[model samples]
Target: MKKNWMALLMGIVMATLLLSACSNEGSSNEADADGGSGEAATEQVLKIGNDQEPAGLDPHKVPAHSSIRIYEKIYDSLLTFDEDMKVQPELAEKWEQPDETTYVFTLREGVKFHNGREMTAEDVKYSFERIMDEETASIAKSYFDKVESIEVVSPTEIKFTLSEPYAPFLSYVASTNAAIVAKEVVEENGDLNQAAVGTGPFKLDEWLPDNHVKLSKNEDYYKDGQPKLDGITYLTMKDESARLAAIRTGEVHVTTLSSQSIPLAEKSDGVEIKSYQSTEYSYVGFNVNKEPFNDVKVRQAISLAVDRKEVADVVWKGDAVLSGPIPESMGQWAIDVSQEELYQQNIEKAKELLAEAGYEDGFETVISTASTYTDMVDTAQLLQQQLEAIGIKAEIKQLEWGQYIDTWTNGDHDMLVGRNSSGSDPDRSIGFFFSTDGSANVWGFSDEKIDQLAEEGRTTIDPEKRVEIYNEAQKRVIEQTPNLFLVSPEKFFIVRDSVDNYSPTANEPENFNDVVIME
Candidate 1:
């Protein structure tokens, strides 16, 4: 019986070893089939959570931040800013300033649009003329007001003739609105509203409004071995809470976090926080065309009573720097107003000014804000309380971005809380807002000297002379209280550990061509 038991045990061990050997052989064969890897192939996808859907993808038409984010993805300008915000050649290989009013650009060879059409100087000329056309009504129309003509010197060379020396000309050429589009593609589609075809690293695969936008990599991109990921998907989470949840749960790879939500986001194990000093300044704008606000004393009184530091602390967790007419982020152009006594918060003085303006008892007014912008909402709420100290009763009117923009642009509000972009050039930041003929002079706040200075600054080519011109413009505008220049906050954006090669830009979306995934 013992011998029979040993034999039986040996037989069982042999059977077990044979089964294990067969299984190992099958695994090895499977690995060989999968290109020497046991794991199945994986597709790297970058998912971004956006707070709002883009109103439109036509870069020349929509200037909203939501739309601009997507524009940075699917468009490339002749010139683009580097990581350090210096001008770098993009579509144009090299450019020369032949004269103060004449600039020339040389197009790169073999660059093609998403539609597989070769890019040429004519496309650049068409794009510029289309933007300058009055029928288009582009926000950039004013930016190129001085461009007298565009000439396609050759298939690869383009020349621009300016009516006068526009100092910020080159900088504006690198701005977001200068994105070049394929002329034939635009004509075929009627407009670029639904179709986004460009000579960019990514091609717009799909854009489902209010849902998500998906893009696929451009295999034929001019820059080789870039756009490391297979594709990118922008998911619209209108609710800030939803955006936060998506990032924390790894449902989305990246998203922006509000200042108040930073502490909560820091606790997420899978998330990484990134921050930068933003070029945006939040303010309570008064329609200088409207009554009470039309009175400079009333504007000054409100500006004095509202403590900027208190607003910064409450709205941004003190993650802000006091700013002047041009935000300090622009460097050299932004005037430091911290030491100035006018910006000092003095409630008694504000009350005195109000009384002098014949409003000892402050009147009722509404503070307009977009519901989606948490920071703006919070800033408005804080201002509502801050204005109370000086007897100004403010009712917060929350609107959707669309309605808010409509009302804000049309100057249909008693007051509005919003943020403005401190553009790459001081002209964009100041000239368009304070000049009398400015299209974006939404506040109806115009001064003769401000207008003259803006024109002079545009015409002047010397940097030092332009600085003096803009400094005087900023000081004069701030004194008139067109809009109360508030604090420039440090903006925080969140990403996952899987995401690499990303540093958040100050005023625009981060280009993801060099971004890669760990797995």
Candidate 2:
């Protein structure tokens, strides 16, 4: 009986040994599957899917939002806007306005650019001067046109003297276009279209055109413990379905979605949708220099013929709000022009105005728009149909983005259906379209009275006074009918559940400095 017990114990030992060997083999296979590491895989990289590639890295060269989004990661501005769109210090620690026309900014100490050079007042002065340089032909020059001079008070202090008391000066300084760049880097690189070096939370590591733009965290960032993610990769996926698929399959962590994709995103699991009232304004502009359109009555007739509410509902899928030239996102500066009779759709009045303008049989016009934006194409088609009801023959001319911009810049189009960004401040919203010398005034719609009012709106310091000035300007603009303002479409962002603290502002790009990735 003792011998039998020993045999049974040996058998048991053999079985235990076999089990241990199989467990070891399984663990080895698991490690091999996990890139030869026994520990579970952890991703430190945050991948974002963008619909289009940025035009360039040079902040002054491109006003495209795609470029601005990338710039927000690679550069630092003097000031920045908070979640509430309030001005806040960024590179500048604090600032003081000594007088109506004089402003001083106290630079943050120990700030280092991506190139390891210490930032000083000289860099700030150079950046502003570069923007104002006529040779650069910067699209952002208008924002700083009010500055009379930039003086360096000290290595860490800078003062700006404006030609007038520009109330929106602080907001302009806070813009992404006003990002402070290293003078030495700019000189070495010449254009800074491909390379960028700035004192921000991240540094541009690599940019593969039409592929991805990669950025790595700045370890020596002045803001301590910032940019929690090790790096970020902006993947360019122009096709909307491709972007949605990338997010759904865990290939990308976040992406912006169009209104049509909102329903699909809502039904998808492990995805969260966040939306904000966009400051982008869509409009149908008439080139006042063109024949027939030169007549204010013709412009007014077209504005009265189309229904903004219908456009907002059908095109935007009920995700937009009707707005005037100044979107409601401008807060108190937005004049209540909804009650204005010109804005109402009066078919009879439109026909009467057309008849009065010697177009009793209607007129032939071409509407030019960029085909890159599907919404704009739809808007043009809708406008064409609406105009047809009043015996107007509208031809839709769709062009590529580059051609569209060129046509508009050269004033070669009769009419245009496009969108413009209305920034956080009222000055940025109104000045670019209405000011006589505004770079975006492609329709040649210029009024001396409107220009004076816009000047006063920016120079006036008191809130009430500024509002009064802007209200008068808006009313005049409506009467002139340079553009038929449409709606402010809601902006949507889709993020993975694992991404935390990824909030996007209405006027600014997404700041990922505090973004965290959950395991």
Candidate 3:
């Protein structure tokens, strides 16, 4: 299984040393930001460690969380999720659902984009219409498929017309995918890939590709006396140990920690580990458009070979629970894969299924994973061992965050290990990934019945009917095996003790507006 006890032990020791070193080296230089160590703490900069570097700054194009982290800083949606995941106002101060198919929103006045132009209802309409446009191919398009039209009522009001009733629509609006953009800016730059102009608390200052993204405070932010920090620096530290080391060395103020690094972070000085339950689920996805996986039996056989419980225990150290196509964080909407026979691992049965699929000797395939996410790497390595038991020779392809995302996004790999956030609703959890036109459906899985049921689940407002629809949908996704559903690990973010008001939100990207770094 490529398990190295020594490497793990060394990793813990190294992680500790790395984080400790950062605190020592950064303390002196960190003082320079405020003029001197003895001077008053001014121009407070919150240095954050990003395990996966953002591929781009565009919200409509890149759905990667790394990119979303920056998007949440640079852009504002009509609505947002509070720390409790309850919907709250953002760009749109208030809204109303006059009917099942209509929504009217009144935009807050004088809210200016990073470029100083006031955000009008036209900008909001343009932002959503751009995503709905077929050419843009936004991954979040499926979530808004019911959006029939958008109309600007006035300079401060926008109206939306839906073709059908979609219960999960509001939650989708709260997603960064629906982030507002400056129409003139997008037209000028071709895209927000290199340039970002949004109405947010922080404005983009400097973005050094593969290095860091620096953001400065928007003095004209709509919120009064908020965004406490003078600036936020997103440091791309792709390695888990390296990130922890950055924390230890005090090179960065905060970073997300993997289960493997939790113990190391917990014991480290000058750090406070804040954790919460999250909607994230990790899975091994098969590109159903490709062979070997093109056949459902092959996909099912491979899925049946791996033990999910073992994966949870070994990888997440029991901090996670077994997940299905829908994650446990979805509550009653999620099916208990532990009770499902399809999720139970059986090498002999898996071999039989492979034989029936005319690959009795098994097949050679690649499992692409991101090098930035160590848990995904560890999961791939363990799956490599488990698959070998059924005679399948699987090669592990570990690429950097950018390449790995590209490989999966373009369906260039047979299979891949990736983790995703499911959000608060089941429709967002399921439709965003497995539905025929699901924005995250890079697995190339498209099914008529699954698509129909997903539509039904969202359109049918009856809670009982929704439960039945999603239940059936979940079972079908499991049987079809587009993805070998794994576990939903808890959220863990390690922060320096100097940082305050650092609570992590369950539904949105990490927002640094309220965070303060004591100099």
What are the per-residue Cα lDDT tens digits for candidate 2 across 1-519?
999999999999999999999987886675444334342236657899987777788987677677888887888889988878889999999999988999999999999999898999999999999988989877778888889999999999999999988888898899788889888777888987888998888889999988999999999899877877789999988778898898888799999877888899888888899888878889988888888999999999998999888898878898998788888887888977679888799999999999999999998989999876768888999999999988899999998766776786778988988888888777776787778877567788889988888888887889998888888888888898888888888888899877766777775547787776654
How many backbone overlaps does candidate 1 show?
A: 0
Which ranges of candidate 1 are over 4 A from the true structure? Answer: 1-41, 507-509
The lDDT per prediction is 0.85, 0.85, 0.85
Candidate 1 lDDT over residue span 293-390, tens digit each: 99999999998988899888888898999987788888889898787656999899999999999999998999999999998999888889989999
lDDT string for model 3 (181-285, tens) is 998888999999889989889999999988999999999999986787899999887767789899987888888988878999888899988877778889988
lDDT of 3: 0.85
Selected candidate, larger TM-score, 2 vs 3:
3
Candidate 2 stretches greater than 4 Å from native: 1-41
Count the clashes in each prediction.
0, 0, 13
Q: How many Å off is the CA of 109 in candidate 3?
A: 1.0
* True-structure Cα RMSD, model 1: 5.9
